[model samples]
Target: METFESLVRAEFTPKTTFLNTASNALLPARTVAALDRAARLRAEGGALDPLYADVEACRAAYARLAGVPVERVAAGASVALFTSLVAASLPPGAEVLTAEDDFTSVLNPFHARGDLKVRAVPLEQIAEAVRPGTALVAVSAAQSADGRIADLDALREAARQHGARTYVDFSQAAGWLPVDGDAFDYSVTITFKWLLGPHGAAFLVVPKDFGDLMPVQAGWVAGERPWESCYGPVADLARSARRFDSSPALFTYAGLRASLTLVEEIGIDTVRAHDLALADRFRAGLAELGHEPVPSPGSPIVSVPGLGRLQPELAEKGIAVSDRAGNLRASFHLYNTAADVDRLLDALSG
Candidate 1:
């Protein structure tokens, strides 16, 4: 097995102290090289068959990462697009329960329907908020604002007892946290952030029965045999979750395939341990400097209140972080080191 230090050294040469994986992750050199190869193939009129194969390869890899069978995953481009499919499936006036300040993609679709009874509670109260009429419980596995992880086990048990379906968005958790797609009725995750892929790759996992979703956005790629069903209408839509697929961005898949390979090779457990250690170091440093970040134990992302203005100065000092809703957000990942964490602290202290 390759050591984590060597892996980081091999894949990245950061020009700055980058601690912003929550907004966008730095792509590995292998993934970038794959993108260049894909671009060249398109420019030189090479056969397109290999690019199509990349889509399936990426789907299978993401399925394994999410701990689901390949048949359960649908390739898509965005969380909102997939969430809208779930939103379209609900009948008018159905109740949906969610966390306060949950990622909007997990909340907005249900709200946009205007007829659904969408209820929001504190993130800590989500599991307890489930009621008899709640038809769905939608929340992010890890929050985008402060990286507070939801109590998924409690939420799942609560939804089960209340006869509500569960939908989890793993956009902030997949690469660094263990994902069990089978535990929820539906799950969606975009690969760009912690998954270290490009902007145009995402995955959706659905129950084996396909639940109540109607593939309202189905296109040529949603057909069981896409190549043959290109005319007036598809002869047969896919029996599996592939029915929800949008026409893939082939270049995106080509690069994502490589990044997923790297993730699997290093393993999620290893990534989590490395990331949380850096996060803990930063948290300790914050304490020494008389700063208190939002409590997000066991999570790699830290959001400190009343420090958003320091983001610009930090950036000018060759450090990168995010200023979200007046919070200075620093997200650590496998690529980060303790030295990097200390560098940010040193800058903040000065």
Candidate 2:
């Protein structure tokens, strides 16, 4: 596990052995660096120039991580609002395909819209459910409850055959797995989890060219010149995904920048390998204790049914985990190691 450990490990002190990464990641010391950097920026006369630079830096960093052009990635306050914007861009009567268990941020936009037809299907049956009228297929890269990952390739192919766009919520999978950014038309990731950023910052990725697309949420920041004038009309929408971004939060961006830097320095592939290995170890240990988890395709999230009641008790012993839908969920991140898994397993076994 040390092979995968980054120097950033020294900075983490969550007060408990946190296996609740799926809920929210523990903050890193690097966040302080970003905060200090922000302070320095404010100390100077004008903070706008450098704050904006941080925004662009974030866009660039996420773009590089997602393996798409920088133009495709946008700075967002949250996945929920931006996704609503994307869903609203669809024409009236456009059908959106999704699963009941799909993350709220990914599917809620379609569900909330009266004009759009939202069809809910089981994740496994999404391929068969894609109809010709389907405008978009919204799904999570990995299920938040049980850590079951969707087959993006099959989903993309199904959406393609029907001329539909696919939106993937990579909240759980992005920094821990090799996300197929090209397979989907749009993808969203809130950085607090695997990306190790703050709560408010998220990244939204769009394709280089949408054959037919409309802008639903046009804020001043989405214009060609956000700094120029908010009162004036946008003569031209931004050529890039920046068009979706509203006002960027420089304070959150500072922490996000540091987190992205950590992810970059350690490399995502290395982080993924570490995550899976620990997950495998954790599951195997649980199985030995006669509390085998429900079978799942490889995912950093591992869930054990009937353990929800145990979570509160375990936390008292300095072991933190998440409980959802009557299941105890243990989420492994880059910061977790074999030892953390042992601590969790020991708590559960006891």
Candidate 3:
């Protein structure tokens, strides 16, 4: 397809037509077909063999896309953020350094714990904040609010100097940007956001050596060879990050697998190009409407300064955007087009 319109026409559902793919993507018909088939098998109470196979395939697909070994990939809810905290696993009262710009979900796991100390520093000061006592330096590869990409390489070097590990939350970056897990010792990602998968599915990548350090959580399925052991004491912590994952949610796995397969078929570079082009269009359109774009040449995210105050009016125009702390966020993705950007500009003009 030469344009986003063609791609959407071919791949998306007609009833859900819209370019707000950054919020929650409209799954392709093929994904829906696969999910339906999987659900049918589950409904019939047949062997759950296919579901397990799909889960493993999903893990492998996500690992390949992330440039990490399948053994190092872990699955869970908010897996990236949770895995980062788990990777820290520091002694009580030890501090974990992160940015104030991070999504609230990243902070929740650490905030809920009393023993672990979480420190939020400005993005500019993150490198300087990684001290000897800091166990991990966690940050997003791209800030979710405004789509500003982080300097992960610099953070990684600083963490290395202090003998601390780096954990990157790539939920907003994956699928739309290139990610090298080696940029940090660990990286967390959610399949839902940029990966365009179903909600409640995420992946965590831990460096090989740190895999065994993950503390086991509830559920017998988390045990090594769970099906093989009846009630035997859980022995031999898993040698890979799979040790951190509990039982697979088969329904979400089915959706995630289909989504990843679609992404792989589209290719990452192509997706990035589409996202950046749309972002540039959005920035240009916002500027024409007398609103300041948050940052020039922004990533998939663009902010219109005044839209935040006009949310109710904009919603009436059939446009969906977020008003966050005084900025209206327009997030671009593979499905957006220059026409969509123009439409948003026109809405803001009034």
Candidate 4:
């Protein structure tokens, strides 16, 4: 068994002090190798059995990570697709309560439908704002711009009291913060960021009874017997949440299988501890330098107000981060270290 330190050393060889996992994650060497192998297999007309197997493996892995039964997990290409499906399922005048500054994908689907009455509230007020008329409470588990952790327990309790369903996006939370998919009526996550997977994969978790979704974008892959139903309407839609699945992204899933393997082996609890320590170190450094970061306690992501202008300068210094809505955002992950955090702080201070 590889120790955590040994596993980190084996998987990563960074070219820079990478502190931007919130925007895009650095791929592990093993995942890159898997991508190369997938490309070669496709170019050589090799058997695609391995690629298909990777898809199922990823579905099962995500199910385990989200603490849901495999039957409730539906594979998709993006969070938007899943959100839109949920939007389409709602009644014409249903009300959706959301965080005003939540990720656009989470908010747009409800608004675009034109018929739903969408209401936006401040993140802190989400739970208090839920009412009996609200049909769904949609928000990210972590704010994308500033990394403020949502009070999911409070929101869930309020939603239940109001008889409103919950749709939580775990895209920014899953790899480091432990998630419970069964806690919400629905949840969506993209695999590229914290999960350290390729770009073409996302996941949606529906309730065990499949909830109220209509499978508006269902393809042959949503059929109970996909290959057999290819040229016609599906003989029968999947009895499970697989009915919501888009066709699997085979090559992307092939690489994700390797990435997710690393995550499971390392354990989310271990990753969270390592990431938060580095993030807090950076926060302490920012305070010493007379800068105040957005308060995001217990989160690996830190956003410093009035520091967005330093992004380009730090990038030139080989320290990666993001400038989001005028805040300098840095996200720490299992691969980062005290040295990496110090390097970024040093660059900023200088």
Candidate 5:
């Protein structure tokens, strides 16, 4: 396997300069080229049929990465959170359970649904909070803000016993961790946050058995036979997750495909190992600087306490980081290196 730094640098385009990837990651050269090719195809008056083919390729790639069948992969935009909401909004008056530390995007969808009651319980209390009337339990495999990882097995058992489905928001964990489809009745949703892809692109993978569960936002393309006729009566809903995919984003799929291909080439396990190594170095450096790093570790995302003013301070020195909950959040991807971590630590020391 190629070195992480080499893999990242080979794909990174110098045209666009990004300080840190945690906020909105910079797309690789392959992704840019693919998108450009797609745009050119459309500009040349190409039909949407060919574009759908490209989208299908991306769907297949994501399905393999997510450990689900292609039929279970649903293409969409930033509606990962929206898809989770639909998954949870099963029956009327059904309560949606989630962690208080969830991404705001995840919470906002259910919060806007007036008919669904939303309950934000602590991670430690999620199992106990899942009751009989609960409709869906939403949990992020890795909490976005604090980088805290959740226990999927525990949450899945809790939801299962209550006769409720579980929605695992894998946005922060998908490309970075190993996701097994058979582990739970999970509708895993993922964005390109740490996946090193375009921002608006994401996908939802629902198990094969949940196809008839009824999606509240079904569209024309969601018809069982979308291509049969533009105005025909809707046929049987798809017997897979594609039923929830109202429409596909051709351009985004092209970009995502390019990015995921690189991920596959480099291997997810290699990426995670490299990131964790860098994170350990970062945490040790921060500890030496008299700041306490978050106790838990999983994703490359690390939080340093009392580094409230570090973001701007580091920015002045050409370093970038995120400030969340009065902690400094630094994320490492395939592009980052030990030297980068050392530079960040040196900047923090000043």
Candidate 6:
């Protein structure tokens, strides 16, 4: 197995502990270079259309990472907007199911519409809630608050049995967990969390059969030919999942593609292994500090007691972490090491 130490070491800083990758991963040098390249190209002011190729490349990368076909992936700015778009696509009177406290990105979209019946149940009880008439079942691949990994395989199976479409927000799981696109009909992820890309870069994957489903929010980029003046007879749309995409900035596409190139080079399986090992260390160490961590196998997020109380203090010491539901959340990505966790533990103890 090739070690990723050098690759990870080169991308980020050593002084600060960035445990809040789940909030937003630090942009790598490669991503910055990509943004700069795009900026230079934009300054030239000729043929802005070719930059759309970057959007396609970004979508293709997400497709491969999600184990889905290129046609299933759509680029977007954020998961919340895409999730809401999918919710809006559902027919009126549709019933949407999710965990009672699933991420706002997962539940808020359905609830905000007030047209569909949104049922928020316990994670364990979600599958049982599925019915033949259920329109959609959306949940996070891993809980953001305390690193609770959902049983997606089982959930998808149950949803399939009930003829329900399954949706997963993989913002927290994409780089670490393999979200099976063949099983789930729809999935979305913001790459900044786990894929180590820029903010405002995200993807939504839809089933190939969804070509007939009109987009609830489509910008000019989603048209058959964005450069052409879309006059009368607006019948033709993107044949691929691109139809659902909004206009992501050119830099967003470039940044996502660049970071994804590094992610692919290091390899997803290796990153997953490294991240889990660090999380395991963090969880064990937190327990030794007399604080129980939320147990979430295969997830990089480890929840500790007094996280919110400690967040400001830890930040003062250049240790970055995020708080969720009153728990300290230390999220480990490929860049984190055991020393980082030790620093957090030491800070809490002192």
Local distance difference test scores for all models: 0.94, 0.82, 0.74, 0.94, 0.74, 0.83
lDDT of 4 by residue, 40-138 (tens): 999999999999889889999999999989999999999999999999989999999999889999999899999999999999999999998999999
lDDT (10s digit) by residue, model 1, range 197-226? 999988999999999989999999999999
Tens-digit per-residue lDDT, 232-274, candidate 2 = 7777788888777878788888888888887888898888888
Which ranges of candidate 1 are over 4 A from the true structure?
A: none
User: Model 3, poorest ten-residue lDDT window?
Assistant: 13-22
Tell me how candidate 2 scores on lDDT.
0.82
Which pairs of residues have clashing backbones in candidate 5? none
Q: Assess every candidate by TM-score.
A: 0.99, 0.94, 0.91, 0.99, 0.90, 0.94
Ranking by lDDT: 1, 4, 6, 2, 3, 5
Best by lDDT: 1
> How do the residues 201-299 of candidate 6 rate in per-residue lDDT, one tens digit apiece?
788888887722578676676777765515544356788888888887788888888899989999888989999999888777777878787778778
Model 4, runs deviating above 4 Å:
none
Root-mean-square deviation per candidate: 0.7, 2.1, 2.5, 0.7, 2.5, 1.9
The sequence of per-residue lDDT tens digits that candidate 3 reaches over residues 64-118 is 9888889888777765446544644766786888898688766666666678878
CA error at residue 280 for candidate 5, angstroms:
1.0
Name the Cα RMSD for model 2. 2.1
Q: Mind sharing the TM-score for model 2?
A: 0.94
Alpha-carbon runs more than 4 Å astray in model 5: 1-5, 13-19, 84-88
Residue 141 error, candidate 5, Å: 0.6
**TM-score-best of 1 and 5:** 1
For model 3, the superposed segments whose C-alpha errors exceed 4 Å read 1-8, 14-19, 80-88, 230-232, 296-298
